[model samples]
Target: MFLVTGATGNVGAEPVRGPDAPVPDGARPVLGGLDDPGTLAGARDAGVRHVVLVSGGSAALADMSDPISRSLTLSERAVRDSGMAWTLLRPRAFMSNAPRWAPRLRAGDTVRVPFPDAPAACVDPRDVAAVAARSLVGRDPRGRVHELTGPHPRDQLAVLAEMLGRDLRCVGLTDGQARAEMERTLPAEYVDAIVRPDVQEVTGRPPRTFRQWAPAHAGAFR
Candidate 1:
């Protein structure tokens, strides 16, 4: 049986299946969180031999000082020591995050956000899930860490503008303002994510670009 952590997250929410059928039977859903290691005890006792963990790139960039990085690092460590085969997927950013701009886009063409000029090679969550599925059901990527990213880095606002068929503008937030806004939800950590071939290496195809992702999720922005 396969045990997937963060199953409701952007990456883990994507279903993983084999050629014959879906693994673990879709009817059963396990409630768990990384904050507590005891939650995994149920799955481990149930004879689950493989675990797929969705860590972040920040874990590789920062040390234990940063809470976000510290959490991801600890999660990765927990999976590694669990004695079950594990795959750690560290995706830079998710294209799905584009939806966060929906309200502003709906209100007007101008969107204000932190790090407007910051280059991010964000990956589609589906691509991350594909690699995870391959590792879970197909191959044993045990004790391996895959840093995933999209095919290219481009202006996400531009892509949204093109997809929504409207003139969109971006107003960059001041560093202090950005930090305050970001800290409301997460500890702000700036990472200039670069493109990686790990997605292609694992899934045998290039990761989807923002342009490709934009069209599919255009409904959210509209």
Candidate 2:
């Protein structure tokens, strides 16, 4: 049987619930973290032959230099050592990220965000799910790491313009500036991680440009 971890997350949830395809009956959702040894035991008990791990691209265990990084590192190790067939999905920035800009777009045509020029190949959660589904059913998918991304890459301002249906002014700020603005509104680590370039590489496809994603999600901004 196929075991799906991170089943409730953006990509994993779509395969089980999205319109494109339905997960076969009896597929197990392995809830909990990789670092938890119980997760491995549960998979074994469930008769899971194939395991798909939906890991964050930013969570590279080999590069862990901090506590947060170490957590990711340990998780990867657990999954790798689980002795079950495995397909690791490391996804970069998610297209769902656009929602963060919703309020700013709703207020006006202007979008104020940090990392204005940082480009990302933001991926659709649905696509990530599709890939995962394929991996689960394929016999040869084990021991592979698939990095998922959109079909194109673009910056936040470009995405804003598409949503606004006109040229939207962007107020760019340094990391410090962004931290100051978001400190009261969001967790500090969240703001810092959101601006990383690794998000583009994990999502392998040229992300759907903001122009493409905007019209589809216009209602959210409106």
lDDT for each residue of candidate 2 in 83-201, tens digit (9 for 90 to 100): 77777777666777888877876687777667666555666776667667767764434787776656445665666565566777777798677667755443332444333322244
Q: How close is candidate 2 to the true structure, as a TM-score?
A: 0.71
TM-score of each: 0.81, 0.71
Query: Residue 95 of model 1: what lDDT?
Result: 89
Cα lDDT tens digits, model 1, 157-180, are 988887777999999888677667
Question: What are the lDDT scores of the predictions, listed in order?
Answer: 0.76, 0.63
Tell me the lDDT of candidate 1: 0.76
